[model samples]
Target: MFRWDGGPVAGGFAPAPAADALRQWRSPDGGLWLAAWGAEHRGTYTGWCVDAEAGLVLVADASLYDRDGLQSALGLAGPVLDAPTLLLRGYQRWGEGLPQRLDGDFAFVVCDLRKRCVFAASDPMGMRPLFHRLLPGGGFAFATAPEALAACTGLDARIPESRLLEPLFNAEQLAHFEPEITGIQRLLAAQWLRADARDVQVQRYWTPGQTRPALASTDVDGWVEALRWHLGEAVRKRLADGVRAGVMFSGGLDSSAVLALGCGYVPAGRLQAYSVLDRGNPACPETRAIDRVLAATGVPATCIDVADMQEQAAGALDALAASPRFVSGRNGFLPLFDRMAAASGVDVMMNGIDADALFFYEDLLERQIRAGGYAVALRCARKQDRMAGEAWMVPLVRRLRYTAHLPPVVRNGVRRWRGRASEWPRLHAALLRTDACEALGLRARARRHLALLRRPPPPAGGLPTQTLHGAVNLDGIGRFHARSRHFGVEMRCPFLDRALIDFAAWIPLELRLRNGHLKWILRKAMTPHLPHAVAWRGDKFHPGSHFDRVMLQPVLEQVVRDFHGSGPAIGRWIDRGRFLAAAQRWQAGQIEAVWELKMLLLLEHWLQHNADKVAFGR
Candidate 1:
């Protein structure tokens, strides 16, 4: 991907960047500047400077799997076309329709000196991040990393308090609870942006809202067969020949299914599966299941026991803390895997994340009720129980509480209680400076995000099937990139394929969620291949004690010490008393997980380390 600064020459702009991360280039007259750094992931798609002199600068970070099909569709000559060339050829031939005809995970910018306009677009899931900032005077800068843009432009990078809620409350996926308003304005998935001297425009090229597909049957066999074909194709597309590849196999339905399908496409000798087992927790439930898959597929695996590498893991985590803000605190386990992949010479790692989004159906009862009332809802739920091999009454009662009529307060309370009452960490209101909180409007923003959780399903599509699609792109994929980039590995998620997602959307929910099992259709599809016990396994086991407690406990005092003396940058936002109180509770073992405390530490570390790398504005 290229990081560049550009604006209309008439606007009187000259781009300057501090970091040498990008290769710098300028037009002969010095009117235009470009900085790019890119590498081809697969085939011959070197994504930079197809014809620099022609003022045709194409920067694309892409994994275009169906090169032959796409080249044929775009009518490009020759047997193969690189992603950038494909886009450039498409632009020459079709202009704005280029993005729609291409199918892959990509983010790109094409500078057409002839049109005097810059065109940029992100793939449907935004697999690659594209962030831009309008310069102070009259210019624009874009980069893969938000901080890179900030560093180049010297723009404000102060963490927005409202955006803080995302990392603080939901650490697993630091997903945006609402559309972006502060921080870097990221281009969402399936969107295109065009900017010039006079004006800038952004629009979504694809919307899941309009993506519903009609299916003729609610039968398991029909949907399962379709899913098998789509999922196999998705996995096949993600595999790169001759590249050392690995899968983040956890032996759960998602990971197992990926590993099973992956072996079919990639040679078993070339493919290795990696798993993290609990330290000293020999009774780890996943081991037996993992063994089952290994025996069935003969796919080699290296299981890293968390207990064995405490010191190294701690050091890796410290290195992570010293870097910029990552999406989630739960990523303490990432460094271990990232290092494993790097050392094993695996440049590409596939994950089964978000399989649940497409495979498992949620709020089915709510959608049925919204469409056809109680009789239809109950009938659907009962049918699901029959397929799931379980009792439906209790879950049905649970779903009833979430019907449209219940007051939000009652619904929220019930959900909180059901989710677990004790472990949840409410925001420490007393911690922030009252004036800063008010100025930033964190309270109001938090309330708005909470309200979004209570929003009822839409009538036709239930919840936009795109929720997980957006989430994986916004938080999960970005986080993976941030960590994996350090090791020169590209992480791919087969489940996030646009075709697979569309296929899942087309299937009736009754078929997808059959019996009481989540991803019932997926289980049925795999039953022919994997042992039933491994294929239909219901529970996913997270190994050992959490890495945070294992890694952070030895260093707890240091975290507290750093906060107490964390300087004005941090103290201006977080009150000392509130932080100390939370730390005390965590030390006393009153709380199982101190997400807020971890967030504070991570934020504090990022600010201190990246002081020169980032600046603040609003």
Candidate 2:
């Protein structure tokens, strides 16, 4: 605990100049030392705050959407306070209840000197990352990004053993494990923490359920219209007053919806689409859809051909080799950010990141079938299939097991007969050592991953589908936010807005996946504004018939080549012979997936680059 009265201090407070972040403002009585750094863009300030009189110092990576509303509620009347100051004032009035009254993507920490307590929280969607560790003597350390936090108190900057323990080659599995960084604990979406001299506590501040009962009562057409209205309002709140805006478009429903709605808010010629054109792949997924959206919307866009993607992966990997700690998928997008910086174009880039996972609840469909017999479920399934452009028999056959629900025994048997126990196939193929699977309990972990996938919707809702999918996809969103900010571009995902996600919870399942389609509700709502090609697109184009294997071949190669130098950090977890064999196949472009490569590379990078910090035998 920090000492207010000059007694013998257990652990002292001071700033590390070498940390290169978190400038300190010392208390008059040396009771606390607060460090803060902030970004000020177009009159919005998100980074730093200190209210000496109130005994609270705030450090945040934030974007407050409803500044006026929050200010009015807090009864503050004056020149607009910076985001951090407004939040501190919110804390002053609401205390730990402050985050509930707030909106937007943010991660913040408030050190209260008078109370001798530290408080920290993140936005419900985890668009911004927050990692911290409570110290033994009630001290604490945190960093928005990992590299800077390595030497701070209460963190271990080494690869977690579970990371090496599990050989993750599946994309979904990799995404699940991606954010389990070494050392500091990442506060998940909707989570907050409090610490004092006595002990520390962490808990969720959000209560999940349909946000608007009135909106939920509306008919299909009425709700669809309401979706459009709510969506436009969401986009408007995210846009800066006079800054240019762009959507990270993929010719998909979610981004298309964002682009369509976002256009209404961004000035003409000021809205752009940052697109990736899948070239050299005959199955070019986005080319046609991109063209249609561009033509229909008449908005300017910058498209990059995959053929023009040259050696950017290598540079990003090399940057990792030079820095310690893990960097997420954002490292792979350095080239895109580079291009944006070169054009000196958009200051804010929006994306459809979580819209895919957040829009619908898969298990809700299963529950619907189980609760109602086949006859009723058949009708509901037909309605969904008809709307989604799918054959009625498809959804019907997949769900027939639920029809035997009259007898619990028969129903259980029928379901068991319909599906095998969920497990990762070829899990051993990822291990270098044959016994590693049994030795590490990898099979059990795989089952848990499957269980996460098959998890039913939370009775209430807080983006159940995404949250239940093992990892909240926070790995991607958090890294994207950190990296974009690193390049001085404010990244916003309107889909991750707490308000929008809450609105999604109330949406009917039939509306979300009509006609064999996903994101059906969003597609229908944006149909008038988006080109039909993009609005009703069936699937996203996967370059090289694979996701990252081809696009990031250079980075993969760099990771594989670096494998020759794998030390105990990697050697302890992965089987060298087995992993290298796969790497050899990957080098020849013969492998379809190499999801484990990035995780290995992250561990290898930290071990090699942070040689001074590593203590394998300690």
Q: lDDT (0-100) at residue 443 of candidate 2? A: 64
- What's the C-alpha lDDT at position 140 in model 2? 66
Model 1 agreement with the true structure over 341-452: per-residue lDDT tens digits: 7677786788887776665545555554555556644555665566445775447735674554565577667765543432223345335666656666655554544444
Error of 1 at 169 (Å): 3.3
Clashes of each: 7, 7
Off by over 4 Å in 1: 1-22, 38-46, 51-55, 157-166, 171-184, 209-215, 371-402, 405-425, 429-441, 451-457, 461-464, 469-473, 560-591, 594-618
> For candidate 2, what is the TM-score?
0.78
Query: Residue 306 of candidate 2: its Cα lDDT?
Result: 59
The residue pairs that clash in candidate 2, if any, are 38-47, 387-514, 387-515, 388-514, 388-515, 388-516, 389-515
lDDT of 2 by residue, 189-253 (tens): 78889877776798888844435546444388887887788788888888856667778777777
